[model samples]
Target: MDRAEFLNRLEAQLLDVPQAEREEALQYYEDYLNDAGDAGDFDILQELGTPEEVADSIRNGLRQDSSAAGERSGQADEN
Candidate 1:
C-alpha cells in the first residue's frame, strides 16, 4: 500500500491507544516514511510491513521496555 493508505490504516488501528502514545507512534512512522521518501524510496511500506504489524511490533517493544524498567526499579528498591 501507499503512504496515505498505510498511515490511514495505522491511525485507525491506533484509535484505542492513548492520545499521547498514539501521536508519538504516528510521528515516528511519519518521519520514518518521510525520510525514506526523501531518500528516493517511495515504496517503504513493503520494507516496513503493514501498519497493523508495525503497531504490534511497537506495542511489544513498549511492553518489553516497561517490564524491564519495572524489574530494574524493583531491584533498586532492594538496595
Candidate 2:
C-alpha cells in the first residue's frame, strides 16, 4: 500500500495509545516515509513491516519504557 493508506491504517490501530504518543509516532513515520521516498531505494513497508506489526512493536516499546520508568521511580523512593 501507499504512504497515506499505511499511515491511516497505523493511526487506526494506535487508538489505545495516548493522543500525544500516537501523534508523535505518526509524525515520525510520515517523516521516515518522506526521507525514504527521497532515497528512492527503500521499501518502507518491507523494512518496517505491516501497520499491525508496527503498532505491536510500538506498544511493546511503550510497555518497556513504562516499566523502566516505574523501576526508576521505585528506586528513587527507596533513596
Candidate 3:
C-alpha cells in the first residue's frame, strides 16, 4: 500500500487505543517513513509489512501489557 493508505489503516486500527498514544505512534511511523524516504528508500512501504499486520503486532503488545498488569494486580490482592 501507498503511504496515505498505510497511515489511514494504521489510524483506524488504533481507534481503541488512547488518543495521545495513537498520535504518538502515528507520529513515530511518519518520522520513520520520512527518514526512509530521505534515504532514497522508496520501497520502505513494501519493507514494512502490511498496515494490518503492523496494527496487529501493536495491538498484541498492548494486550500483553494489559494482561501483565492484571496479573500483577491479582497477585497483589492475594497477598
Candidate 4:
C-alpha cells in the first residue's frame, strides 16, 4: 500500500492503544518511510509486512503483557 493508505490503516488498527503509544508507533513508521524514501528503497513496504499483520502482532504483544502482569499480580497476592 502507499503511504497515505498505510497510515490510515495503521491509525484505525491502533485505536485501542493509548494515544501517546499510538503516536510513537506512527512516528516510528513515519521515520522508517522517510528513511526508505531517501535511500531509494521502494520495496521497504514488502519487508515491513502488511498493516493487518503488523496490527495483529501488536495486539498479541499486548495480550502477552497483560497475561504476564496478571501472573505477577497473582504471585504477589500469594506472597
Q: Looking at candidate 3, what is the lDDT of residue 10? A: 93
lDDT of each: 0.83, 0.91, 0.83, 0.80
Write model 1 residue lDDT over 1-79, tens digit each, in one string.
6787888899888787778888999998888888776554455777788889988887787789889999999999999
Selected candidate, larger TM-score, 2 vs 4: 2
> Stretches of candidate 1 above 4 Å error?
38-42
TM-score, model 3 to reference: 0.75
lDDT of 2 by residue, 6-71 (tens): 899999999999999999999999998888884442476778989999999999999999999999
Backbone clash count, each prediction separately = 0, 0, 0, 0
What TM-score do all the candidates reach, one by one?
0.84, 0.92, 0.75, 0.75
Best-fitting candidate, scored by lDDT? 2
With a 3 Å backbone cut-off (N, CA, C), the pairs that clash in candidate 2 are: none
Instruction: For model 2, state the Cα shift of residue 13 in Å.
Output: 0.3
* Shift in Å, residue 15, candidate 3: 2.0
Identify the runs in model 2 with alpha carbons over 4 angstroms from their true place: 38-42
Can you write out model 3's per-residue Cα lDDT over 1-79, one digit (the tens) per residue?
Answer: 5677889999998998889778988898898898777554457877778878888887888789899999999999999
